[model samples]
Target: MAKKVRFYAGVEIDKDGIRHTWSADAWQQFMDSCKKESQAFEIRGRKIAGQCESCYSPAVFYMHLTKSRELSDWPEAGDASGSVSNLATRRDQTGIISILEYTYLLPVSGTPYIALLRSSSGPMPSAIADWVSLKSDMPAAGKSFELQPVLRNDARQKLNESLGVKSLEVRFEGKPDPNSTSSIERAAAEAASTIDESDYANVKVDMSISMGRATVVSNSTEAMRKQALSILTNNNIAKHPIKDMLSKGWVTKLKAKTLQANPESDKPIIEPVDFIKEHLTEDADFGSMKDDEMTPEIILSGMLEAIGKFRKRSNEY
Candidate 1:
């Protein structure tokens, strides 16, 4: 049998700062109208306030199902108006009970209604929870409601069975001083000066990139992962290579392997030469370097190159 889905109805408010309320009679009428149309209750950017000169912007109110639960007899705004009216009346008489299931006011603007609902619940599905937490915002506008926890563990397990990864750490040096305005000024001043490669030798940019093991069970689909990373990058969560590194498809592939491998039995995958080649500046002369020839300076230079490419590509996009 196909899995059942349940949906709940809520009010959506448009405009940045306006409030609307439904009178008992108006609410009943609205419910009746929804039932007549066989549609969930929605206000299409209509002005609710009387005597207000400024028109409220268009907004949409709609119903959607919760991620984990499946319940029956969810009142449909247009198809089951009577059922919804009856439920609302009962809640009013009984002083608010759970018979109506979930109901909340959706603010007109500034906050996303779906995000507000998600916030009330526990952790979101693993795929998005981290990215959502990091961005501390709803997914970008058009994509907001599309994020659904549709990938079940069985599917993930199947994917896990096909892929493997090796856990590795990439360390880079020579980060700039965030607090030093003078350093920035100096760089600006030196923009026209002759290049001095040795001046950067003592500069320490201490950073570590954790190439986390991927697992089928906890992993999100590649598309979802990429979306999450894009959101992070667009929001400027971290500088360059950190953001760029995580966005790589290989990283996702590696993570899947890492997660599936037995910690005690599987050996970690290592490919220093491949890693360097992918991330390093193509213009740089590596001089027939072998995997064993990989140096800290070379790795750091590659990382910096990757960062530059990421910045350039992002600007182009």
Candidate 2:
């Protein structure tokens, strides 16, 4: 009995800009390609937690999702098409940021990252201290991308257990609250004189991702209420849902990497490892402090470090 994994793969867009569907569609295609490679690649099926399984080579995965209609179905385009030019983009503005987020995962083993790329002067890659992540360039030309939700292995097992993970599909269309403060409502209001108290709002919407497809879900508020989680106990979802998303496709490797010798950023999420490493030279063993009370300040200061060192730390009884 595998648990069903459900997560949102969406890009932010303006509700009125007309590009929402286009953005969502393009991301869907990019994720689809990565999924294909995972299922087809060799090493990805070889090792799981360091054992032979279906495919286990160092694996790499990516996702690209948007809220645009034109770009939504580009995944269906024949081989003749590859790039999505401005002609393929549209725009929309919703009260909400209308953000669309995609997710990608890579094996700890050195592989390539495809969902995102850079100009050599772009933002520093999202690599944690004690462990650095490196990715390869995009496989397609004329298309630019950025990697996000870069997670390691805190979520792989749960993903494998959940088949058709996030395979559920549903769409959403919302009515403006008479007292709502979303920017889109003001725009919609300015366009009309005192909208009818019962006027229904609408947009031509479509949404799809690696494991699911859908249009707008009616009565979105109700839907959300129904979907909210009740018990955090026994819940295995990661703190960052994006990273878990990165793990779905073929995974090839999960090797440990060297840390930066000298860095400027005060934050590397590795303060704990650094603290312990420094102490190890003097206090090689826990001595009598294995049961010592750890303080909140000490614990939170090294949370990022704790997160980094956590790889399949859970033991099965």
Candidate 3:
């Protein structure tokens, strides 16, 4: 089966509390710097932990990670397997490694979007976001930034199709950091301060929308629906924890059109390269092809196509 490639928007926050979309030049420089640092770490002959490596295409990079682990095994059976297994367990030192490729594409004069090929063994979207924040050389960019997912093509549609929402719920614990530069976190902090509590172990916010109505919808109800959809879809600046909960199939008493059957969910998964080639309008050479071989050129081309689609849709919107 082909791996799934997810998309994200590349956002950078400046020192003066301004958010800016990274230009192609800025992204190129950042990746080059990360590649250099990753190379240096590799040369030391120590575990890379997790670092980005340059790919054949400058837009793509391999996130290399090494983890030391212990391998355990049951002792060999002598007379009876049950008796021998209960005697002792053997342990050995081992390590795990992964190389996940990701791509960043920014038009010379437009919005920026990134593509990441997902794998169970690879880093997650949030982890990749953190990697960019921690590894980049740009000042103040790390404080409040993320590769925000464009969920318009997915979750937003579901929300629109929903019969008016009964309620949208989000549960949280503790208080948000007051000094955080993130607008979402700042808003949360302000709300928490109004309660005059230093911390909250468990706080559930359930927002009623249409009072369990379905057919009839009001303007206020529509507005609330839009905001709820935004948070659920990750269209907003910060991702809400409720989004994670929903992904895990958790739901309460709330009822909406979002819970309805989704036809697109049954579609077959396609590899990024295959999808790009099938959708391509022109002949492009990828050199020699090997079984399951993914070259940097192929990854870059596929990601560029994905980003182009995103940009087109964005412009139309």
lDDT of each: 0.25, 0.22, 0.40
Tell me each candidate's RMSD, in Å, in order.
25.6, 23.9, 14.2
Which structure among the candidates has the greatest TM-score? 3
**Tens digits of per-residue lDDT for model 2, 1-317:** 11112111122223332212124344444335444332211111211111111221212222211121223322221223563433223223213222222212212212222122111111111211001111122222222222222232333222212211222122212221122222223233344334442332332112222212322223542222122110010012222212222111111111111112235753221110111111100001111254544322222223223222332222310
TM-score of 2: 0.17
lDDT string for model 3 (27-69, tens) is 6666556555543122112222455565566454544443222
| Model 2, position 50: C-alpha lDDT score | 11
lDDT of 2 at 67: 22
Q: What is the lDDT of residue 149 in candidate 3?
A: 49
Instruction: Give the Å shift of residue 311 in candidate 1.
Output: 22
Candidate 1 C-alpha lDDT tens digits along 1-317: 11111111122122442323223343333323332222121112211111101112212232121222212322223223443444443545546443222211122122121211221121122222222222322223212212221122343233324333223222222222222222322232244133243343223222222334433322343433333222221111112223222111111111212333345755433222222222111122222453334333332333333334433432221
